[model samples]
Target chain A: MGLSHQSIINMQPDVQLVAVCDSTRFVLDMLEKYTGVRVYNNLSKMLQSEDLDAVIIATPSKFHGPMVRECLEHNLHVFCEKPYCLDVTEGERLAELAKQKGLVNQVGYHYRFVGAFQEVKRLLDIGAIGDVAHIKAEAYGPVVLRPSGSSWRNQRSEGGGCLYDYAAHPLNLVNWYFGMPESVGGTVMNKIFSADSEDEIYATLRFGSGLSGQLSVNWSDESYRRMTTKISISGTRGRIYADRQECQVYLRDGGNLPDGYLSGWNVRYTTELTPEVWAYVRGEEYSAQLDYFVQRIKAKEMDNINSFTSALQTDRLMRMLIDDSEREPIAASGDYQPLAKGNSSWWQRLTNAS
Target chain B: MDKVLFGDNQFFGVNHMSEEKARAQSMRFRDTQAMIDVLDMAYEAGIKTFMCTTHERIGEVCDYFRKHADRYPDYRFYPGMPYAHKYANAVTDHGIVGAIKRFLPNDGLMDAVVRGGSAVAKKEIDGIATLLIDAEMKMFEGLSTPVIFLQNVVTDFLLGLGMKDAFRVFADHVKTRYNAEPGFFSMNMPRLLDVLEEVGVENPIICSNINKIGFRMCGGVDLYQQILAQRQFRPVAMSVLASGAIPPREAIEYVCQLPKIESIVFGASSRGNIRQTKALIDEFMAVRQD
Candidate 1:
């Protein structure tokens, strides 16, 4: 949040940082010293005292719904973090409220703004990967390894586990492109991390048009540098394997790229597209996403790709995934006779199956 | 089960997410020889146990095993039953009765049917359950099946339905009928352990998803480790790569270093993947032994 505040001050001069708010006085005072802006210990007090243009809610997932609601009530253009709300219905209400007020509300799904992913959106839009059949989005990281995990993250109500927190990045990106899947089923496993929430999620999604998708998010493994989210899109024409830093496009039909970029794999790096930045702790993405939010607010653009509706859609998908997983999990294949291949008359069985 | 069990996922068209990959695999392994070739490679690489699903395709594998029994005396199968798709497809192609007939063991026809019918008639779930187990175990009749796992689809379903005792029935029948110790594979292992304990299964041998990442460990990874540390059930880690998200060396080292991991099960189509995975596991296992 401090990095983002520094980012706004460093990049967008048009959008001034009037004040900062935090629960801790030390944090507020430090921000006040750094930015030379008024600081408040309470968000409500900050809201009442300052004539603010906007609010950035980067608090815990539990607080997002309330803060966004309050910000929307004040008609403030808001940028909230992912897991837009702890509850989907609340997220829906906020998205609707933002819509009604014409507020430039954006969720911090920074992966969408990553250069490689942006390029993926372009290539996909241009039918580079011709009629997508399946998308496999995986984000694996060394988030938690111990049996007794970090406090709030393990709590299902607060952090919402790997499903709510980590998977949100890929889910946000996939939802941005595919909207909602027709149906979803898969299981979440707490294979090793001793948290109330799961360290892994193995999910399957089926779109109405028969586009099959799978999501795998595992944070318990110590193999990754950190959370490296990768999305692999398999289409009729070719395939794309993408991460934050670069994208590899395998074009069976090199229709999108220029001549000589033949029917083979071509690598595209995001580093070149990413503008050199001096501030912001987490690369150019945070700066880029924050700047886009400010620009949208300046332009009065109510409907950006990362708008409230989009975040709400992602949230709804998470809920759907959670529900579908319990009722109808897509188990890994093996050969065994179901004891209850019991007794069903052929007609009843056929009708029920259909 | 061997310390490293060669798996059947590649033969069965069960790529975790991509239908295209699954289809490609199905195509690649469409010929039975294609599968046998990979098995031969594994055997050459010193992997002796073929921990597999009882997929109908595996019948051919059993045939291959029977043919080469004299050559590879140490080669064995650790079979898991109720590979749900086999039954689902059987029902689709052959209907219920035909499917049941197809699955029923040759040695017992009227006896198995009577047991199945009496179970239904008496509401003694054990009878039909044992009958199905017998049916599923028929193909691996002569083959060495040291540990037969109850597939997760049925295990988790029964667990969800609160059918804890049925597991006991399965365990008992597996011991008595096949002279094999019953093992279970579940999406939810901790809960399954609780059910197992309730049904008097002490320190059971269970196969589940266990990796550096929880991948599919039911209950949390921490709880699984705690359970392992406590010396509860024996845990065979499957999906240790967490479906290819982890680097091979890192995944092998992390899991191999852990306590009480009885075995690690993995699948590979190419000799390269098989060899690489085996080398990593061997290196880690050697270090752990040291």
Candidate 2:
């Protein structure tokens, strides 16, 4: 992700990549040698040395809180990567700090920029999928087929495994659509491949407005070439299904429809929906989110899509899932014998007859 | 480019329509010989061009073709660069620089590094891009790769980045260094054509999604039709089946009847599917020519 950001930043006309900091000496050495950009191993030293307007944090999930706080303390606008912070309270406090400081803060929930998902948001906003009742958010990929060794990605404390690394995408989208769930239930985090972390997660959530949602995520699915996140919404009048590639909406005859959509089915491809970005790397969304950050900072606009506050909502939802999963199952205390010795008269008579 | 080209997506696990099918195909082709059998079927069906990605397993395929050169003399490969996952995994296992070092052609380590380092120092991306291209091309060595492609992941990325000069860099490098025409695979053919034209790549061969239902066509089906009618470039249609959304005959007919479509690439695991698709494409092309 850092490399992708670097490529996009290099191509942006308004952005000048003055310096880069990484813990890996070899990576920094290569960057300094090839790109001639100043490199640093220590974040504090780099922050103090460089007179920068903003900092883009692409570190692990665990490091986000402190790094973002440090950047905010330096009076720099920050664009931090996703799974904003592992601790919800810490994220809330940081989000408050950014808000109080009037900083142009953004989180790297790049899916918000995908055209198909954006279309879903628009259609839902316009009540195209009239009063969505149930939604299923899913994300699957072949990230950890077999656990070889410990990395930040599969470590519970570092990257938060599939819950953060994979589920965070669709979960963020769900949070974007429906702010936060009122309560969560039946949460399960199963360790399929990784020893320390969960590779698959399932949870049921209920929004304040009585809308229900199910979260399903698996990172060890080898069928997919890459991460594929999808969301399907069922409403009173219609249903909507969306992924990075396209969005398909089905509407009944009763409700108000968008301009191009029909009653039965309407499909919108990402190509037609996505606006051209000046610079692109992994996806248009990546470049678009960065461009939005830069533009918002230049305009001194603090409120933007994928703001720290918005990401805090996702962080809180993840906390809820973890808490729900950790709760003990409600099991009856006493084991029951099949007939309870004296209870089943009819069964006893049948047995005597037999 | 041939009117019908075979793709390698099915061999790898990329179904798009169904995960079950993808898993099945992946399991079926776990043995290299199984994949070789399919390729042999396509070859026997008279499809010579194998447009494929530079996945690590493709090295084994290249070795097979090399060993059986006499059996398939007219075989050709249209190799796409930087298999992406390979580099991504490398970046994870090793650092960025380490990954680059690992993938650089083993023959000229110092020269490639110096070139890459100097290119980075001078802020000239061409040198690094060409070096990586050479690394990806290493696996295709000693094979006939007439048309090399820049995968859509990077092609659309550069397109969105508005780095037109990089397209020229890739084209020039492929032409001058490899003696092969450069091809681009993008989701948005209309937009890519504009960029390639601005970069002075005339009548370039571009591969993109061109299905009847506008499946994966970026600028919509109508805009693509307009571009196909007006643009002076070789359009190679892909994803014409739209991941099995449209009937095979209808999909092939829709794409084949389009103006200026130079080639059609499809992947099928079975010999019957291959023969059927190839026969359909041949039938459509013959009818259209008349």
Candidate 3:
């Protein structure tokens, strides 16, 4: 919270950090102690006073929606954390309301702000993976692991589970690299920690380009914070695999430069925090997601919250999956079997699919 | 030698905007119109062959040129159709899996596409076919004079899917049904050759696939570059400056060095850019002759 707060404070020095609010006063006290800012137990009081320029929402999933709404209603430009809300309806409402009020709103799709993913988007546009026949994306980690105790995240009410919480990061990045899929259906399993929220979700999405992809996210692991998200996209020219977290692009043959010569490979690619975030804040081709809100305001681009409706589609899909009664567990395999034929039936296909 | 090609990409036309605010913005911010003005300026700068993507403003654009035809009577303009939109529509309309199943003879593939949500939805497929029909009708009716259909073989599923034989059958079906020359435009050379050989399609068509990397469903930039070098297909190179990233001087210099590189497509967004491009062309020909 200190570093994240300092980054924002440094960016908008003119705007004061009047008060910091969190359910646990420990982090709030920490912010007030370090920054010498006033600490508040209530968000309403903070919004009522303090003559603020904008609000940076860094609270947990449940509080995200109402806090953002309170800020927006007060005509505040908002930069909220990922999974802006637990579900799509509230998120879409917030987005729409933001747009209707002409406010600059931003979601924390931080992967987009990273240079590595930007390079991947550039390569794809330049035909790095040939014609992009298919893509298989897998993200594995145990970031959401909680001790066998009552935590807000483990409960559905608090928006603290695998499908809703951890999976948002990869889902947001996938939508960024590839546009929203035509349709989505997934199988979610909860074998790891057995929380109300799902532990694993196997998702497949088809792009408008006829290229298809499947993604699997699992929170069942005993690794040392290992997050491996890889995307393999095949085209007529060649196949390209991306180490998503690291932003490494592995190609079939060498280009003008050697394979993986584009930029930002290995550990440097996976390292998501710090100097890069600072670089982003400073605005050197990197995204200052907060500054983007300010710039949009200055440019009169903040006309509606609905601008982010497209970004929120994945949230809706997530909620749907969570509400689904029939839970299917897919084997952990990265290999995708390309369809040998085509789909002709909806009901018959579903019944006689085998 | 007798023509200069101009390439412009657009999403919507000024007329599509119904609201007053949008209309005003369209007139001022219309990327396509801005490009056309630049093309005309290039013509004054002595360019003749112009190429463009098919657009909804076909009639208005053609009328704009037809009125000034005497000034550019030698100009050959080709409007390439957007093939990806067709595939997008077809997949949407015929349920992506359904179309693939109908097209692909194998059943196992059908199940994969059915399960794979990325397959084009039935609505998208229908939309594409409808758009194609509309584009085809406009071309046949001569809404644009000698409406050049720059075959969009790059992004369309009609050509990909390893359906060269099927494309041949489809092409013949289109020819018999439509009575029009529908097979012209830039295409994947290998696939085109295969389809042409299988279908006995001997019509001399101009190639428009230049500077673009990869096919609709495969590969990397290196592979595309290699294909350009080794491939037997010779195309009227569009995007000669590689999406206009390379400066005119460098592009001309590079084009001059390339052997059998035929003609170059010059796309300019401004009159000043057109002038610079003209100067580059003059310098290139002078050096080539010398």
Q: Which prediction has the highest lDDT against the true structure? A: 2
lDDT of 3: 0.54
Kindly report which residue stretches of model 2 are placed more than 4 angstroms away from their true locations once superposed. Answer: A332-354, B1-47, B56-68, B93-142, B146-290
Q: Cα deviation in Å at residue B240, candidate 2?
A: 9.7
What is the docking quality class of candidate 3? incorrect
Per-candidate TM-score against the hidden true structure: 0.51, 0.74, 0.46
Reference-based lDDT, each prediction: 0.75, 0.85, 0.54
Winning candidate number (TM-score): 2
Query: Lowest summed lDDT over 10 consecutive residues: which window, candidate 3 chain B?
Result: B10-19
**Judged by DockQ cut-offs, is candidate 2 incorrect, acceptable, medium or high?**
incorrect
lDDT of 1: 0.75
Once model 1 is optimally superposed onto the true structure by TM-score, how far is the C-alpha of residue B12 displaced, in angstroms? 39
Q: What is residue B242's positional error in candidate 3, in angstroms?
A: 33
- All-Cα superposition RMSD per candidate: 21.0, 6.7, 27.7
Best by DockQ: 2
lDDT of 1 by residue, A1-354 (tens): 443444334334466667767675544543454335677778888888889888887766788898899888988999888878878787788888898889998888989878788877878887787889999989987766666524555666785577877888898888877878888775555556654777788888888777888898898765553467888999988888888766778888545653334578987655344453322233457766887888888899887868888888888888887776667444456963434544766876898799
Over B137-239, each residue of candidate 3 has an lDDT whose tens digit, in order, gives: 4532433223334354331233422223434443453455455444445334444544565556654244543443221212333443565466544445555
